[model samples]
Structure formats: C-alpha cells, structure tokens
Target chain A: MELVRIQKQDFSVTEEIELVKAVSKSIGGVVVFLGTGRDISKSEEIVRLDFEHYPGMAEKKLQEIRVRALDNFNIIEMGIVHRIGKIEIGENIVLIVAAAQHRNDAFMACEWAIAELKRITPIWKKEITKKGEVWVEEHP
Target chain B: MVKIRFFAMLKNKVGQEEVKLDVPENISLEKFKQILKKEFPAITEFLDKKSIMISVNQEFATKNTMIKDGDEVALLPPFSGG
Candidate 1:
C-alpha cells in the first residue's frame, strides 16, 4: 500500500524523493508536484494564507483518496503530503509524488491525485490580502 | 440517537460543532433537517438556501436517504481547499 500523510510540518524535496525511492525497487519514472502559496488573488497582493481543517475528517478523507488512486492506477508507489496552519507567500502547500515502472502511469497518476485532492479534501484556505483576509470558495 | 457534525463555515454559523438528537425512527434526511432547524433556530437561515453537503457514516449522502440510529451525519459546505 502507499503511504499518505496530511500534516502541518515542513517538507523538503530531498526527503520526498527518498520516500518515493523507499517504496519502489525498479521505478523508471517519478513525478512530483509541489503547490506553493501565491502572492496575488483577484488582482490583490496576498500577504499570507491561513489553512484550517476538521482534524480527524481531513485525514480520513485523504486516506480515502489515496486508496482510490492505488486502485485505479498501476503505479508502484505514491506519497502525498499537505501542510496546514499559517503559511507565507511562496511557501509550500502540498506535495505529491507518484512512481511507476513506466513514465506514463507516473505522470498521469500524479496529475489525477492532486486534482482529486483539491476537489474532495475538506481543508479550507483563507488568503490574507492588503485590505483583509478572505476565505476562498470552491471553484465550480 | 444520531450524532450530527458540522464543519468550516457551517460550524461558525451554527456556533457548535456537534449535536446529538434522538430523531424519529425511520426518519428521512429531509425530515431530520427540518427537525434540526426547529431545534437550532439559529441554523434556519443557513439551511434555507445553502447547498449543504451531507455525509452519512463518513460518506456523502443525499437528502432523501434514510438515517438510522447511531449514524454519524456531517454537514459540510462546498470544499474550498487545494
């Protein structure tokens, strides 16, 4: 099974690669996406961002997403890490890594994983702008 | 008894995260919602027009579904996360 974690800790690129390598023996390709806090929202300068989650429910939902990805894809290994609490502009927000015996599976699974996470996860973010902070709403 | 949970904006609006109520036996979700509104008058405005998502036993559910005793129901607004 894949290892999934939703935490409020800082993650390093080197650490993420190591985690992926630990699960796959003959991995031909690995794809990773790191989402960062942006500086602008609705044409306004964002100073910082705040994230909140329903502790237990958030972790449970992430685990369900991880299981669904494993069942649908032929990837050998996957790791997802999402940060919580206050984050500054340009700081890392989420990380996803998918490893597979072939490049296509790695790339596609990674893309699908993050998209589903954004769509289904219960974590909420508020953008701190120059004027005031506003909680973001779902897009479509 | 069923435990009803709320999150995010709904929690802030309701001013409470969870509540336990003894709903009528074999009650539909729609009726349960009505009962909730009667019990918590403050939530009526939010329940009127907001597209609140329901979760029965941690899975997404619809309004017509039947809820049983001891079921854990959650009211979630549209997810706003990345």
Candidate 2:
C-alpha cells in the first residue's frame, strides 16, 4: 500500500526515493515523473504560478487515483505528491513514483497515473505571465 | 438532504462553496440545477451559459442523472491543473 499526498510544501527527491525503496522490497524497477512550473506558456513568458484546490476534495480525488492505479496495474508501490499555493518558475509542481516487479509495469503505471491526475483532478493552476495572468483550463 | 459543492470559477460565480438542499427523493440533476438557479439568482449567469461539469459522489455525472439523500454533488469548472 502506497501513500498519496496533495500539499503546499516542497518535496525532496531524496525523501521520495527512499520512500519508494522502503515500500517495495521485491521491486525490480522504479519510475518517477516530476512536473515543474515552466517559464513559458503558449509563447508567453510566465512570472509566477498560483495553484488552488478544493482542499479536502482534492485529497480525496488523489487518493481515488492512487486506488485506481493499484487496481489497474500490477505494481508493488506508488506515490504521488502535488504542490499547492504560489510557485515560481521551474519549481516542482507534482511528483509520481511507481515501483513494480518489472520495468514495463513501472513505466506504464507512472504514465497512466500522471495522465489521469491531469484529466480528473480538481486542482487548478493560474499562470501569471508578463503579458497578463491567465487561468489555464486544460492540460493540452 | 443533499450537499452540493462548487469549486474554482463556479464557486466565485455562485458566491458559495457549498450548499445543502432539501430535494425531493430521486430528483434529477437538471431539476436540482433549476432549484439552485431559483435560490441563487446570481448563479443563473454561470449555470445557464457557461460550461460546467458535474460530479456525483466524486465521480462524473450528467444532468439527467438522479440523486439521493446524503449524496455529495459537485459542480466543477474547466480543469486547469497539471
């Protein structure tokens, strides 16, 4: 069983790696994805980004995603962390880690988890650009 | 009784984050929206014309769907998260 978290604090890669190692003793592979704030959106320069979420609901949704991944994939461990509040350019936004007995499952599950998170999660990000602040509506 | 929640832009338009409605048993989401509009006229502008998604008990739902007491309903705006 893996833990899922949605918070406003920064995460350390070392801590995440250690968590992955501790959960899956039989793991043969680990896959991780880090989503970061980018400097540009649709050819405009971004200054800062603000993320807002429906607090309790957002956590519940992330837990549901974690459960769905476990039910759909043959993975030993999985964990996801999403950052909230204001963030600067190049800061970490989200992180996912999947560990499985095979390399293929680990990679595939990680991708699926992130894709589903983007599609279904209620958290929204607003980008403050040099031109103006715009609320992003879709991941496209 | 059912509790409905609104988030993001929808929340801003409705000027409320959540509301409790004493709906008749087995009321459809469409009728619920009507009641909401009547109760909160400010929401009419957002509900009548804007694109909003519904979730029943945290899962996606359509307007024709029926809801029960104690059910949790949510009106979501266009998702903009990574």
Candidate 3:
C-alpha cells in the first residue's frame, strides 16, 4: 500500500508509520523522516511558516516519487504527507515513512524520498519573520 | 481558451491564481510564455532568471511542448518542501 496526501491538518507520524507497516507481514524494518517548522531561518527569527502548493500537481508529484521509490528500492510501501497553510514553529510540516524487508533499504529509500520531494514537489514556504514575510525561492 | 495558473511567488507576482487566455491552438510552450511575459511584466524577472517552470496538465513541460485550448498550464517557482 502507498499513501500520498497534502493536507492542512496535522498528522500523526506514529499512525502513518503503522499504516505502512501493516501493509506487509514480511516487512522487517521501517524508517520515518519528519519535518517540523523551524523558528529560525538564516539567522532571522521566524514567527511562522505559510506553505502553499500547486493543488493537483503537488499531489501528483508526490505520488510519482512514492511510485518511483518503490520501484527503485526494495521498499514494500511508502507513506508521504505534507501540511499546508499556516504552520507555527515546531509544528509538523512533512512526513515520510518507508517500510522494507531490511533496515538499509528502508533507510536509503526514506532519505531519497525526502530529497526527491524537495526537488520536484510544487510546494513553497514563506518565512514570516519579525520584520516581514518572504517566499523561499532558492533551492540551493 | 487555455487556463494559465500560477503558484508560490509567481502567483503573488501575477496577482492572481489563474487566468484564462485566448491562445492559438498548438502554440509552443515557449511562445505562450513569451505572451505571458508581455502580458505580465511583473514575472519577467523570474522567467528570465529561469527560476520559473511550466507544467502542462500537471506535468513538467518543456519549451517545445505544445499547448492547446482547454489545457491547464502552470508557472511554478522553485520547490521548497521537504
């Protein structure tokens, strides 16, 4: 089973990992990566972050990453979720769960999925600092 | 008419989420973008800097990609998601 979602509501990482783990009995290991809203960015105090996405295309790109990871890695299933709208500091921003028959496969796939998501997903974040708000456009 | 969508900083620059344009059928994506740049000068910097990307029907599109009436076209800036 594979799950890909873009939502404004926060999600439970444990629950998401459990759902992926339940997909196969032979799955021996699971790796999860959680991204939370940070209070500081580039030495500036960020009060909050506002995330925006390109609607249909954002979800489509995420699903594409999941399918590609499953095909390229030994993972049995992958779950990905990204939160949108206004997010306060320390709030959950994204989650990725990778389940595989071995720990190395899960670890590698989980890392690759997050990197790919950052690279291709049509999502953006604006840093609401004490001074002002600025949309983050630099990928490097 | 084809629908042109904008997201992230590009949306803010364009001052709208989406707009309808009476574009010629089978217009190359490059030409369509040229028209857009002429129409919305605010986004010209992004287009020139190559910071913007075009997607047709929710997929990445190239300059040679052909766009037709009723197709969904989007201008996407760099992705920052984790």
How would you encode candidate 2's per-residue C-alpha lDDT over A41-65 as one tens digit per residue? 8888899999988667778878888
What TM-score against the true chain A does chain A of each candidate get? 0.93, 0.95, 0.97
Q: Give a tens-digit lDDT track for model 2, residues B24-65.
A: 899888888898789878767767765667788877787678
State candidate 2's DockQ: 0.63
Candidate 1 stretches greater than 4 Å from native:
B40-51
User: What docking class should model 3 receive?
Assistant: high
Chain B: TM-scores of all predictions = 0.88, 0.86, 0.94
- Work out the TM-score per prediction: 0.87, 0.85, 0.97
DockQ, cand. 3: 0.84
- Residue B78 of model 3: what lDDT? 86
B1-82 in candidate 3: lDDT tens per residue?
Answer: 9998988888888899999999878999788978998999999889887767889999999877999989999888888887
Ranking by TM-score: 3, 1, 2
Quality of model 2 by C-alpha lDDT? 0.83
User: For each candidate, C-alpha RMSD in Å?
Assistant: 2.4, 2.8, 1.3
What is candidate 3's CA lDDT for residue A19?
89
lDDT of 3 at B11: 82
lDDT of each: 0.81, 0.83, 0.90
All DockQ scores: 0.61, 0.63, 0.84
> Under CAPRI classification, how is model 1 graded?
medium
